[model samples]
Target: MTQQTAPCAVTERVIGIIAEVLDIPPHTITPETRVLRDLETESIDLLEFGVGLNAAFGIPVADDTVFLTSLRVHLEEARHADADPYKMMAGRYPHLSCDRVACILRTLDDGPVLSVQDIADYVLHALRAGQHEKAPSHAG
Candidate 1:
């Protein structure tokens, strides 16, 4: 694929992963959809999203806090920008910086291998931690 074509394809696929994970209609999820507003995606969802992205691109971006923070920045920009969200994300996230994104695209472009459910499970675990803290206990 040409350099130009590659990003478009990757963006579409990445958004698809997000949509599928959130159980929302893929068509409704523009790249601009705020994880909080449009999708109501929780933080756990973001973590899971990261995992799916890593699997797809063939890169290890999980431990890279800098890149994860950058991805959040890009996502916020995309949500606020009045332009093509996928394109905006493509420019901000870029192929080189976001290893998780690159890994996701690679996984998609190469061949179907692993499922994203494992990653989703990880996300649930993270979400539960917060919930556990807030829940009232009756251990008397």
Candidate 2:
């Protein structure tokens, strides 16, 4: 698939994985669908989802703390600098919507379970950051 279509493919795969793990129909999972609020995803499910993402995309999908901490730090810095939090976050996470960022900010105390769209955005970020690559072959 072309670069333009790669995101869509990744989104579809993410939804498929979520649906399978959650035992929910793929049709019900949208980019805005909340993992914790809507699906009531358990901790184990989140762990499995992270593993699935890492395995599928060849990128690291660590615990939410890393991303959450980074977001909080950015927002705090933006607030201190008298910058618009949404705009600052938009600059960093171009793939996410303003509404999504707002939702994440509002839910900061809740571990930022993240929407399907959020996960897709993270995957895209990883791909753009050059985090995804084939393992080096050791054939001699």
Candidate 3:
């Protein structure tokens, strides 16, 4: 199945940020691009990415929300704790589809999959959530 691209204002900006951090052409980056695996990014790159995104989007991405920096750790922890790893991953990465989460869990030994779309999704989610939090409140 071909993954449909989710092109948007936020997505384009994310790609630009990623390309800059990775020192690659923006055209090479796509929603399906895997940051860690495909881009060969290190932990420092992720930190720079988090900073870049925050600077560009004004959204807090320090937590494992936008990026699945601790995917393996979380999964292992869930297994050790006798918890449903799927449920935990789905909860933490609500931006990703359940199918994607399942796929990530299945091939986790190969590597964690954190796509650009996932990052864009979390940015959009955070922006929407922030808007709601700042909305006019009748209870105020």
User: Which run of 10 residues does model 1 get worst, by summed lDDT?
Assistant: 113-122
Clashing pairs in 2: none
Tell me the tens digit of each residue's lDDT in model 2 across 28-124. 9987787767886887888888888877777877555323436778888999999998898888766566777787778777765467877887888
Q: What residue runs in model 1 are displaced by over 4 Å at the alpha carbon? A: 1-5, 62-140
Model 1, span 28-75: residue lDDT tens: 765444444445666677677777665554334443331234444554
Give per-residue lDDT, candidate 2, residue 25: 93
lDDT of 1 at 108: 39
Q: What is the TM-score of each candidate against the true structure?
A: 0.43, 0.67, 0.81
lDDT of each: 0.48, 0.75, 0.78
For residue 24, give model 3's deviation from the true position in Å. 0.8
Ranking the candidates on TM-score from highest down gives 3, 2, 1
Task: In angstroms, give how far residue 73 of model 1 lies from its true place.
Answer: 12
Best by lDDT: 3
Best by TM-score: 3
RMSD of 3: 6.9
